[model samples]
Target: MSKHLPLRDAVLSWLEYAGSLSPKSHSIVMLMLQPHWEDVVMAVAAVAPRDEHPDLYAKVKGDWMLDHRTLLVESGLAEAAQLIAQGVSVPVSDVADSFVTFCTGQARVPERWLLLNATFPQRTRIALGRHTLQTFTADELRQTVPAPALNGLHPWSLDLDLIAGAPFLHVPDPSRTVTRRPTWFDITGPRAEAQHWQALLPLMLWDNELLRVDSVFTVQHGRRFDLHPPAVPTTIRVYPGSQGREEEVEVRDTGEFHVRPIHLSALTAFCTAITKKIDAITAGLTHTRRVPKLRARRLERAGRHVVAAYQRTYDDYGIWEVEADELYLDYVIALEALLISPDDGKDEGIASRIRSRAAALFLTPTERERTEALVRRAYDARSRYVHGDKIKEQSEHEKLEELRALRLLTLQIILRWLVLTPADTGDLAPLLDAAAQGTGREQHIDRPLHAFFATTSPRSRPADIVLT
Candidate 1:
C-alpha cells in the first residue's frame, strides 16, 4: 500500500489532477472546488505557522492557485503566513467531511448547477399593462414578476448583474447570434419543477385580468459526450384567455415523450366574472348607506370569503380540497350574510330568506328553481363538512362540477345585490312580493346572471314553495 498523505498534500494532488483536465471539465472541477476553497485555504494557513509545515502549506496554496487558473504566486502564501505569525487564528475544520462534500458535489452554497448550462433564447418580454400604467425600472420589474422560491428559500436571487438595461428585459443567453421575440420571460429555478409554476398561477390571476403567459421552454443538457449539451426541450404553456389552458410536452432521452392538455377556460371565465362583481361589490360596500353598519360589516366579511375562495380555486391545491366543499361553504356564508336578517334565528327562517332572495335575484324561472335547489344542497353539504360527516360516494370530478355550478350561482346573487343597491340600499321586499304574485317580469330589475343562468328548465324540479 502507498504511504498515507496529510490533508494539505491530498488536496494539492487533487487540484493538480483537476487542472490537467480539458477546459470544460476543468470549469466543472472549479465549480466543485469553489465553495470549499476558503475553508481549505484556512486549513492550510493554520498549518503554515508551525516550522515543520511551512513548505507543505506553500505547496498546497500554489496548487489551489493553479486549479483556479490564477498564476501560481507566492505572495498569497506569504501574506497568509504573516497573518498566522501575527497571531490571527485561521479557523480549521476536520477537512474530512468537507472533502467528502466536495467529492460528492453537495456544497453548502445554494448554487443551481443545472441552470449554469441552460441556454436562454434572446429577448424575453413581460407585459404589465393590466397592473401598472407607466414603464417600470429594472428594480421595480423584478419585484412585480414572481420569483421562484423553494420551501421558502430562493436558490437563485435576482440581481442587476443578471439583468441587462432599461427599456427591455435582458438576460444572459449563450447564443449570441440568435434574436428571438420579447414575449417570453426567462425564470431560473432548481430543475424547472412543476410545483413552482403551479404556485405561480393563482398569483398571476389574483387581481389582474388577461394575463397571457407564453410557453416556458426549457432546453436541458443531454447526457452525452459532446462539446455542448444538446437542447432537449420541454414546454409548459399556460393560456389565461377565456378559460385557462395548460399544455405540457416533455421529451425524454430515448425520444419518448408525453403530452397533457388541461382545459380550464370555463373556470377562468367564471373567476373573471366574479372578480368584476367583487369590484362592484366593493364600490357598493363603500358608498351605500341603505345597508345598516352591522349588516355592511357582515357583507364585507362575506366579500373576503368570496375573494379567498376565488384565489384558492386557482391554487395548486387539488380540486377535492379547493372546489366543492370549501368554496360552497364560502358561497353559503356570503349568501347568508346578504339575505339573513339579524333576528332570523332558526334554520327554517334562514332557508326561507335564501329562497325568497333567490326568487328576487334570478332573472328567469329556471334560474330561480335551479339556484334554490343549489342553495339547499350546498347548505346540506356545508353542514355535513362542518360537522365531520364524510361526504360519501361522490366522485371528485362530479363534486367539483356541482361546486362549480353553485359558485356561479352564488356570484350571480352577489352581482344582483350590487346591481340593485347601485346607489342606495335597494329593498328586496318588492322583488320578493312580485315573484310571489307571479309578476316578476313587470319589475324593472337589472340582469347580471345571463352567463350561467338558463331561461328554461332542462329538467323539471319541485316548484318554488315559499316557507311561511
Candidate 2:
C-alpha cells in the first residue's frame, strides 16, 4: 500500500534542492553507456553470496527501517552510501510491467515481496540489479560494458540460460581450436545489470597483492610470483573444456548458443560484490545520472584506442589467452595504450612507463605501496612464464590472484577514465601527471583502487559462503 507514494516526491525534492545549486539542474549529468549485449550466467550450486553493510551487523535482519533506507539510497531518493547492502532483486523497466498481474493478481503475494500500491504501474520497476550468479564463456567478453540506461531504466533478469533445449549453436570446425562454444553474458540487461557482466569479461586477461598503503608493498600470502603450471581456468567456462581451447574461440557472429557457460564460482562471488561499487561509480550524470552521464567527448577521441585495448584484452587470444605469462604481457600492452603518451621518454621502458603512469592515474601516495611490488613481481613472473621456466616452488595460486588485482585495477581505470574528463582533448597521462604533482586526497581517483587488490578486499571472500 505504501510502495509508490514517496518516490515521485523524492525525485521532486532532489530536483528542488538541486535547482538552488544550478539554474539548469536537470541538464547536469548523463551517464553515456551503450552496453554490449551477450548472454550471461554462472552458478556454482547457486551459492547466494551477499554483502552485509557493517551497519547491518549492528541491527537485526529484515529490519523494515533499514530496507526502506537502503532502497531509498540506491534509487537516489536519499543521501547515503550508494552500494546495495541487501540483495533484493530489483526489476528492469523494460520488463517491469511484464509481471504486474503476477505480482498483485494474487492477494498480498503470501507475505513480503514487491508490495503493490495504488500507483503500482506508475512505480512498477525503477531499480535494477539482479542479485544472482552470471555465467558465460570467458571468450565472449568482446563487447563493451555498461549498456546505456537513460532516465529511469530498470530491468528484470530474464535468465535466457534457463531456456530449456534451445538448439545448439556450435562451432562447425571442431578442430578449429575452440573446445567449447562461447556463451556470453548478454548486455541485453539494463544499465545496472550490464555493468556487472562487463567487469567480469576482462578478468581472464587480468592479481592479488594484498595492497597496504604505508609500506607501498606488503608481501601478501601469495605465490603469485611463483611459477606454477598454468591453470585450466574455470572462472568463465560453463562446460569446463580443455585448457586454452575456449580462448581460441573467434569473435565472429556465430549466432546465439543456448549453452551453459564456464561458471567460476570464485569469480562469480568476486564480481557479484565488486559490481555494486562499479555501478555507483560508472553512472555519470546522477552522473549516478551516468545521466547516470559518462563524458563521451574523450571517449569519442580515445574511443579507438580504448576499445582496441579492450579488444586486445578480451578478444585477442595468442597474446593474452594462451598462458599466464602471455596474459600478463597482454595486460601490460593494454595498460600502456590507455595511460602512455607518444611523448613518454623511450628511456623509461614500457613496463615502468605503465607502472608510473598508472600509479599517477590510479594510486595515491598511501595506496601505491600495495601495488608497487605487485607490478615488479608480475613482470618477473612474466619472464618465467614467457620463457617457460618451471620453478619447483610451491604453487600458491598466486598467478590467478595477481590477475585478479590487475584486472580489477584495469577495469576501474577504464570505467572512471570514460567519464572523468570528457572535455579535455589532451592525453590522460599529463593530467594524471599534474594530479601526482599536486597534493590532495581529492586529486586521487574518487575511490582508491589499491584497496580492491588488498587481501582485505571484499572480493576475496570464499565462494561457498551464503551471505544472502
Candidate 3:
C-alpha cells in the first residue's frame, strides 16, 4: 500500500473506506457527491492529482477550488491527508466525524422535480407531458383526493377544510406596490418526471415562439429549480371574451386545455431520450465528463456537445438572472459547446472555428460575411472579459442588444439542432465545413432545419423576429 495519496484520491478513499468490515456492503451514493466533482474526477483520472494538464477549464468562472476546500474540511480528509504525508495511512472514511448510511439493493431513483404556479385566462385542463394541468378549487381537491388523504393534509396546509371554495388565503398586501401573481392553475394527477419540462410548455404557448421557457413561466410565478426551469402553464386564449376581466365574466371555459397532444408528447419524448446524454455532458463539462452509454456506432464528439449546448439553453443557461459578463459567458459557452471541440482548443484558431462554423451552419452565404464578423466580435469580447481585460464601455441598452444577439444565435442554433439530433451521431459540423468550402450539402442540413421551422408556426418564432 502506498504511504501517501493525492488529494482527490484521499477524498475518494475516505468516502469509500470501511473499518474492519466488508466495503462491498456499503454502497456509495453517486448523487451525494458534490455537483462540481467533475474537475477533481477528471484531474485525478489517468494522471496524478499534481499533473501535466493545466486544467484551465477547471477554474470554472475562477472558483475551481471553492467546493474542494469545503469538501476537504467537512469530510475531515484534510487532516487524514496530512497524517498520510507523515507516513501513517489513514482509512479516512472509517474515522470520519460524519456518517451517511449508503444503502444498496433496489431503491427508487428520486428525480429532482420543479413545480410552479401559473395563471391562465381560461381554466383549461390539458395533459402536459404525462401530467394534467388545471386549477383546483378547495371543493375540487376534496372530491378529487380521497377523503382520508384530504383529512390527512400536511400540517403546513393553510386550511384543513377542503370542502370550502378556497383553502389557501389570497391575502392582498397593500404595503408593497407589486403583489405576487395570483395562482389560477394547478396541475393535478400523477406528475410525470421530466428533466426539461420548461422546454415542453413553449411548444404549446402561442406567445412563447422563442426557446425562452423562462418567459412562459417567469420567476414571478413561484419557481422551483433543483436542476432546470419550472413547469410552465401556457395560455392559448383565443378571444377577447375569454381573457379575464375585472367585471364578472361568464365562466364559459370548462376544464380542458386541448391542443394537438402529439406536439407536447413529442417534445417530452425528445427531451427524455436525450436526458442521460445531456446529464453526462453537463455533469463534468470538460473532456472528462461522463460519455454517452454504449452505442453500436461511435457518437460524434461535436454532435454530443451540440445537444449539451441545446439542453443548456433550457436548463441553467441563466434565463432568469445573471450578470452581464456572466450572461455573456453562458451564451459563449453554449456557442462553443455547439461549435468548438475538445480537439479544436489546442490551436490558436478557436475564435475562427466559432465564427466560421456559426455563420456557415446557421446563415445564408450572403449572411455569412456579417454573421461571421458578429460572432468573431462577440467571441473576442468574451475572450477579453474572461482574461481580465476591460474593453470599450457600452450603455446598458447597447450591452443588452449584444446579449440578445448572442441569445438569439444560441436559441436559433438550438432549434435547428432539435431536428438534426434525433440520434447521437450525424454531426452537422461536417456539412457546415463542406458548405463553407463550396462543397454544398446545403439541403441535407437545411431540409431538417426548415422542417422544424415549418412544423413550428411563424408565431413561435422569437418575438424579436416575428412580425405580428
Candidate 4:
C-alpha cells in the first residue's frame, strides 16, 4: 500500500525546513499565508483531536488534510506551491511574487452576491447562469465584505418586516420557477409617509375607468399597513345609481381625476401661493386688537377648505360637464363659507350675502355689477344641485363652461381674500361687516373679476338659476 502524505504535513515540513534556512525565508512564507492564516487555522482545528479519536484519528486527519488541500487549490494557491517545488534555489522574492499573482487571479466577490447576502430573507441558494452562489445571512455578508466595500455596496438595508419569512433568490435562476410578488423595501420616517402620500396622490386623482381594467380599485380610509400612515379621510367613489354614467358620478367624487404630469406642476405653485397668502393673513392679524378666537378658528377652517378646493379644481380637467359644474359649485360653497358670515335670521339670505361680500372684497368698481350677477347665478346653480334638481335645461357643454367660469371666479375671490386680509383681523366677517356699515375704504383690486369671466359669454348663465 502507498503511504499518502497529508497536505498539512507537507506544508508544515516545507515551512519548518525553509524557516531553518534563513529568517528571510520564514518572513516570506508568513507574508504569503497572512491573508488566509485564520482559514488555515480553522481547517486544522476542524479535524478530530488526537485524544478524542485515538483509534481512527490518523484517517480523520487525512480527510481534513484533503479538504484543506482542495480549498487551497480552489483559492489558486496550489500553483504557487508547484512553482516553489520546481525551484532548486528559489529566491524568497520569487516565491512571494508567485503567491501574490495567484491571489490576484482568484475569483472576486460579485456584486450580486453582496446584494443577495445583504438583503435575501433567508439562507437561499441561487443559481446565476452556470454558477451557484450560496445563501449568506446579513451578518455573514457584513463580515465577508470589507467595511468600506459593504457600506458602498448596500446603502439601504432590507426591510425584514416586509420580507416576513418569504424565500428569496440572489438573482432569478432560469432553471427554477418561483412565483411571488416582488417586494419593495419599506421606507420609514415622517418624510417617508409624506412621500408615500405624494406618490399615491396621482393614483388617487386618476380616473377609475382608466385603471378599472388593469387593477382592482379599493377605497381604503384608514391605515391598512404599518407602512401607510393614516391618510386624509377622503375617498373617490362612484355614485350608487350612476351605472355606466361616469358623467352622473358626483363631481366632488370624480372631477379631480384629471391629473396628469403637467398638473403636478401646479401643486408646488398652489403650495407657494397658499403659504404666502397665509403668511400675509398672519401678519395682518398680528397687528389687530380683539381678534376673536371663534372667528379665527372659523377662518382657519375656511382656509383649509379653500386650499382643498383649489386642489380639487386644479385636478378637474377630465370630469364630465355637469360634474365639473358640481365641483365648481362645491368650491363656491367653500369660498362662500370663507367670505360670507353666517346670517341667523334668513338662511335664504346666504347667497345674497356671498355676492355682496365677494363684490366688496374682490371685484373692481367696473366689475361690481357683473361679479354680483355671476355670484348669484353660481349660487342658484349650487342651490339646485344641493336641492336634488338635475340641471338639464341648457346644453351640457354650455353648462360646463359656465361652471368653469364660476370656478375661476371662486378661485379669484378666495385668492384675493387670502392676499388682502390683514393678519390682525383674520376673519373676513369683520371686513364684510365694516364694508356693510360704510366705514371701510374701498381697496384697489389688482386682479379684476372680468379676467376670469373672459372664457364665458355674458349671455351664459347657470340654467338651473331662475332669474328673479
> Tens-digit lDDT track for model 3 on 1-468?
132234335345444432222333322333225343453344334332323323211454754422343234323333333444444555444433121111011112222222222233223343433433443454544332111121232333224132122111111222212212322222532222122343232332232222221211111111111111112223344444445743433222112223343444443443443343334333333343222221111223333332333324332223333346555565566566666543454788777877777776554666567668767767777878889897458766676566556655665554444445424434556666676776764465656555545554323453222222
Residue 261, model 4, lDDT: 40
On TM-score, the stronger of 3 and 4 is: 3
TM-score of 2: 0.32
Question: Any runs in candidate 2 off by more than 4 Å, and if so which?
Answer: 1-322, 362-366, 383-396, 439-468
User: Compared with the true structure, what per-residue lDDT tens digits does model 1 show for residues 21-80?
Assistant: 443433433534533355545444443333533222324544522222111111122122
Best by TM-score: 3
The local distance difference test score of each candidate is: 0.39, 0.31, 0.39, 0.38
List the lowest-lDDT window of 10 residues for candidate 3: 220-229
Better structure of 1 and 2 per TM-score: 1
**Model 2, 1-468: lDDT tens per residue?**
244223323333333343233222222131101011000001100111123222111245653222322222222322111111122222233122211211222111111011000111111122223322222222221110011111112232122222112111111121121111121222333222122233333231122212100000000010000101121111232343587443433211212111122323433344444444344433433432221233322222232333233334332121243444555555554455556655666774767655665565544454455545566666666667768885224334554556656655654555444334323233556666665666543444433333334322333322222232
In candidate 4, stretches whose alpha carbon ends up further than 4 angstroms from where it belongs are 1-317, 342-347, 425-427, 433-439, 443-468
Root-mean-square deviation (CA) per prediction: 18.2, 24.2, 20.6, 22.1
Q: If both were scored by lDDT, which would come out higher, candidate 2 or candidate 4? A: 4
In candidate 4, the residue pairs with backbone N, CA or C atoms under 3 Å apart (3 or more residues apart, or in different chains) clash, namely 281-423, 284-422, 284-423, 284-424, 285-423, 285-424, 288-424
Query: Against the true structure, candidate 1 has what lDDT?
Result: 0.39
Candidate ranking (lDDT, best to worst) = 1, 3, 4, 2
Each prediction's TM-score versus the true structure: 0.40, 0.32, 0.43, 0.36
